[model samples]
Target: MPFGGEPPQLLKQRLLYQGRRFSFESSRLRLPNEQEGEWECIRHPGGALAVPVTPEGKLILLRQYRFTVQGRLLEFPAGTVEPSEGPEETIKREIEEETGYRAHRWRKLGEYFMAPGYSDEIIYAYLAEDLELLENPPGQDIDEDIETTLMTVEEVDRAIHSGDLADAKSISAFMLARPFLK
Candidate 1:
């Protein structure tokens, strides 16, 4: 652990709701400062993302509709880490399904927490290169409304700066893969 610390003393814990991808929980605990309170959080299986690059030096992205936000967001190909699967496996499957491309080379970017205040969702990110488009690509899930898009490195940076691409994980992962980009 990098910045390790003793966890709060848990007094009681209860599961509030269990969904397909995550669960909600409430806990009563005494903090290190000796203060006691009830806290709620979301427990997730984690997520994996791939920043796929083409031989033409363009990045593959998506305009995805998220019902919660009631709009489309620009994002990289990603999926939840399923049981018994590594992060790499999750992203590998997702990249193909979402983008219709398979990557011959991969480089691990890094992992980071999405929201510490309410959820324990860590996003494992990777840089995917040497992509080959599949003739018979596996389609996306029925519920996903996604459109594949390609952009240059500068375009992505401008989108981030202009608030056009507001997805946090996408922005973070792009910054991580930036130094290696040509």
Candidate 2:
């Protein structure tokens, strides 16, 4: 069967909560067994992330505080996809804002649903190279307290193994770009 059997049908949807970046929606679904139930879904506009590599074979990463986790995390430069903005535009802007580097080259690595079970958040991953430091980078957001860091591929591997790089999105983005890294 195309959908493995009779597909569940959406009967109704109601917004439970709304936030700046996401929303919670409750959906009523009719199942294959003719049972009806409700499921909560986290709706998001998704985002883009860049695994930036310098000509010197170093990777540009971010160290930022995540309030949700109540701790700092090491992550790649990333940003939410604003309405009417493409993924590439979001990543380019984010890399420059977060790392003060502009990439002359970019390659679409892949995309993944970060948390499929609860959230409809998909992230477009990109590999960025040919970087040049921006002489006058745009001012970073006041709410952001980001510290940019450069690391060799080996250093990144060590961080991954040591669990120092625990941001799931960044780890996944790095893995996607690993094959092309020097």
lDDT of predicted model 1 = 0.97
lDDT of 2: 0.92
The top-ranked prediction according to lDDT is 1
> For model 1, how does the per-residue alpha-carbon lDDT over 58-104 read when each residue is reduced to its tens digit?
99999999999999999999999999899999999999999999999
TM-score of 1: 0.97
TM-score of each: 0.97, 0.95
Candidate 2's error at 41, in angstroms? 0.7
For model 2, the superposed segments whose C-alpha errors exceed 4 Å read 1-7
Considering only N, C-alpha and C atoms within 3 Å, which residue pairs clash in candidate 2?
none
Q: Quantify all predictions' global Cα lDDT against the true fold.
A: 0.97, 0.92
Give Cα distance to truth, residue 17, candidate 2, Å. 0.8
lDDT of 2 at 123: 96
Estimate, for each residue in 58-151, the C-alpha lDDT of model 2 and write its tens digit: 9998899889988889999999999989999999998988889999999999999999899999999999999999999995788888999999
